[model samples]
Target chain A: MSERPAHGWQTVREEVLRRIAEKIWRPGDPIPNEADLAAELGCARATVNRALRSLSDDGLLDRRRKGGTRIARQPVGRATIEIPLIRTAIAERGARYGYRLIERQEAVAPGAVSAALGTAADAAFLHVVSLHLADEAPYALEDRWIVLGTVPEARDEGFEAISANEWLVRHLPFTRAESEFSAVPAAAARSGALDTAPGDALIVHRRRTWLGDKPITQVDMTFAPGHRIRTQQ
Target chain B: MSERPAHGWQTVREEVLRRIAEKIWRPGDPIPNEADLAAELGCARATVNRALRSLSDDGLLDRRRKGGTRIARQPVGRATIEIPLIRTAIAERGARYGYRLIERQEAVAPGAVSAALGTAADAAFLHVVSLHLADEAPYALEDRWIVLGTVPEARDEGFEAISANEWLVRHLPFTRAESEFSAVPAAAARSGALDTAPGDALIVHRRRTWLGDKPITQVDMTFAPGHRIRTQQ
Candidate 1:
């Protein structure tokens, strides 16, 4: 029987990575055109194009419309931060996950929250405050606003048993999102919820999700002191 | 006269994104197989495959080897953080960029630094501390260690005019890197350099880069208070 052909784009991508890692194609070196590379590797030109595009997205290669492809001279390291479900993140650490809803009510969104969601300052939203715990210790304090105009169901459903974070993931469809990462001193009110002292350094993660052009939710999560987001590329 | 063919992978990708955005392919819905999609779109099977794979990488689709592809029910929002050269970042902000070498000396690497670099505990490294300024205001304080065994040229040069951050990027070839983002209280020593009060919240970014298995350098950058990293997807 003939062996299965190993000409997939993934195999091509691996070969390209190997060449760069081994310095076979040194930095700033211009790689062969896709057509030439496909001919040499005995694969379709489309396969080579796909592999090169993937590598370029990863910041390993530079491809210009008319400049062909070259190994990146000063490769900007790209670290992909995948914001996981808070409960899943806790469970992944071999810790028991706990969540408690502190407050849920229809309230007018703050000016910043309104601006982030592209809603009016007087827009009423389903406001939710909750705490996520890992091993019964404070993990993250979540403050969320759901645009009632886009998600009318949120106003009726009480988020007492389930967090809006998890509920929205199951109920809504997100097509786009924006996130901001910063450091902030914990306010007195939030510090009590997170079980940290006031003025303690905290990692603040603010995120907004959209379904098409309609805003779904805007959330700010303040992690307990010493929380870190780590990634490798 | 025939018009140019519009059957590329990019066209397929755009169509897929549109369907998802329009809720035509709702979350958790299984998408058509590659062969069927290719026939329907009048494109090659490889083009459909490439488009689907790209979407899967972006966390929009979940493709199982035996189960086929489906729209992700709980799509993980991926934020790509590109760590740019400090000078370039400042210039992009429309600020005058400035750099100052606080200290540069050959010293024994600290235990934590050596461990991070995968070097000996007693390894001697080029220790460099520098301050990056935007519009004459301190932006970030950088503490870096260069592995002498892998980058011996760093030991001969004094980083007085150009920062080690810029020098390494121009001289080295990076195959892989790891980054960590955390919140920390500014220490007294660093607080002075950043012109911030002690115990202020700061965004601490730690990065280690490698050429294959060999470590090139490890650096810790502590940004001034209120600095935020933002990204959209």
Candidate 2:
């Protein structure tokens, strides 16, 4: 063996990695052992072990405590984050995003809402209903309730023209959030939101958010038919 | 008004989350607003908002600035972790995960190998070839080269009876990793090792990892038809 300074093994590992990436080799394929490789490269067998050990960590190569290293049959799934704008999503998809106000009411909080905010049962509240459109088509019909107990400023929040969804983002600094998902058969009135025939499968999401530990907002959303959900990083 | 402690809203949110787990409420469905709901339950609207907003953060809901909240659409792809398991993945699937040692040769580091390690030629190394299996079928073939210069301890390791994958995991401590994925047609020997007809689509993963700043390992993996990869939290 040449008396060259150490650090040669890294080269071995990289070349091997490239061959594998280029499909020069394949998954589940065995490779040469150390002694044989040492002779071929005119070096020592010790160098090859250093490289193989590293592949085992990233969940790419499977190495048994006693078995040799091999390419993974399955791959690690990658996640990507995708945040889209509603108007953009609609316009790009050959549809229109529309909105309509349905009903507006002011009422005294019953016991539950009052208790939620540690207020009196008659605490003031705002209630509103609206329909949403995508591509000029009915997409979602929303019925929402807002508490004005802690957010007494909400008494004049001007929700009649601006939607609650838009209002909060511009005005709030929400920090914490939680969500749940499921699939259910649609009811007649709600099923019309997705243009699906009644009794069709609809994906549903329920959510709540808080600024610190203080609850800020809650919402329930329903999607149209053939709409997909994805989270990628 | 009779004053009664309210606890059911919390219970309702919990039930809603459970319903999501049970696929009852899908990704998107508009829920009843607070006032209308208070009339039904004789409670408060604050309770409902708490439940809904919590569900939003769990990646199950889409609340827009103005479009109203809607159930998220599931993305086509998912995160799939390629757990490094050879025997279980092979035998369990009725397909085989297999391995076999090929020739081992000692030599100087190859040109590409030296460049990756930022080393000069005349560096000592070992070259090896091995075969991997699936369902009693040859799946991946490895042609690797190891460097003795960096991993001096590797000089003592032998390949006659013991496999390299087994030895490396017990010894190495890898920290950083990089991975790339692509597709390719089959090569000459790959056609035989994979038993494929050749000219078929194959998924591949190329990965390299390091211990701290010192590069530790590099590996490539290829997949056959009818193989699925899944990654999730």
Give the candidate number with the greatest TM-score. Answer: 1
The weakest ten consecutive residues by lDDT in model 1 chain B span B1-10
For each candidate, give the TM-score of chain B.
0.77, 0.62
Off by over 4 Å in 1: A1-71, B1-26, B29-71
Query: What tens-digit string does per-residue lDDT give for candidate 2 at B32-51?
Result: 45466456655566765665
Q: Give the TM-score of chain A, superposed on the true chain A, for all candidates in the order listed.
A: 0.76, 0.58
**How much lDDT does each candidate structure score?**
0.84, 0.53
* iRMS (Å) per candidate: 3.5, 13.2
- Model 2 - which docking category? incorrect
Candidate 1 pairs with clashing backbones:
none
lDDT of 1 by residue, B160-215 (tens): 88999988886666767889999887653565799887657899989998865678
